[model samples]
Target: MRTGRPRQFDRDEAVRQAMHLFWENGYDATSLSQLKAAIGRGITAPSFYAAFGSKEKLYKETVACYLHSHGRVTDALWDDTLPPRQAIETTLLRSARMQCETGHPKGCMVALGVMSANSEEHRHLLAPLDTARARTREGFIRCVKRGVENGELHAGASPDTLGLVFNSFLFGISTLARDGVPLSIIETSVRQIMALWETFSVKNGNELPNG
Candidate 1:
């Protein structure tokens, strides 16, 4: 009987494990040795290099995986079916919940992973994080513009101002989640902050949707 050889390691699972290490320690703080240890199954340094090229390359892959998986919730910002306010609210609430999940590192991977880039190499590895944040701001701006166009917001409202405020609030929530704030408290805070959105809305008895 000829039996095929067993796979060396689960590549997808290895990437996920490495993602958690990077999420916990950020770029410069994480090390190749730490990554090798985390990947487990006796993955050697040569094996790590063969599988992922370099530490920077692996981190990039890990970030992509994280965004594609844990960060997909923010895609709601582009969902035209949802009212602008609802889309923004859904993104914040979902982000808060994901940040506080028990099994993963606290706070957002994108928000926390790129805070202290110590070198050009580190910053280069972190470019995607910056792009993600920029996209988030842009998405909020588009949502605000949609609100104005849909008659949900005042015609003279500034999308840039509203987008900045909400984007800052969302990032602040990520910091708060990392600082150990409970999800319930964060959700309550979201409700209060969203009330401010209603004050800017068009004056036709429109109300912010209750969660």
Candidate 2:
């Protein structure tokens, strides 16, 4: 008699399901049972261990997956080709649209992870999220610096402060999105936020840092 083959499951789908669960309930709340249940075809404990090694490992995988996919929306921030204003606006509007989309979970996983970072385990697991956020903030800062260099934003405008404002707003948007705020309203709010940048025009650009 020929030896029988062990049943196989879709690992990619498993990570996707795990991503949604983590995004919905956060890091510490999601249980092993939940992960097993969420994964398609229902994997056994042995198979689960064999497939993922452990929950922490699986969480790392899911986070990486999230970054490569949904997280790319913010990548517009780093696009040097886009004008400074357009780059910032694109990231804001695109992030809002993604957070409010019908499919998958609402809100950004990275932002959600940051907010739910209460436990040490979460903090450790959230290294990638932290890096991603820092990258986003850096992107904003780069845009402001570029704007200054090109005379688009005038001179002596503090890049750090300007970048923080948008970064703070971007994270706040995740909270609003998770709170059921509609996309259209958020989009309008983004435009209003951009108007704040316009106020920092070349007219008052050379103002001191205290201003």
Tell me which residue pairs clash in candidate 1. Answer: none
State the lDDT of candidate 2 residue by residue for 25-81, as single tens digits: 888889999999888757788888888999999999999999999999999898989
- Residue 36, candidate 2: how far off, in angstroms? 0.5
Candidate 1 Cα lDDT to native: 0.85
Off by over 4 Å in 2: 1-5, 115-117, 203-210
Per-residue accuracy of model 1 over 1-211 as CA lDDT, tens digit each: 9754444889999999989888888888888888888885567877888889998888889989988999786898999999999999999999999999888888898778557366875788877888898899899899999988988887777899888888888888778988899999999998988887787787656654433
TM-score of each: 0.90, 0.91
TM-score of 2: 0.91
Question: What are the lDDT figures for the candidates, one per model?
Answer: 0.85, 0.87
lDDT leader: 2
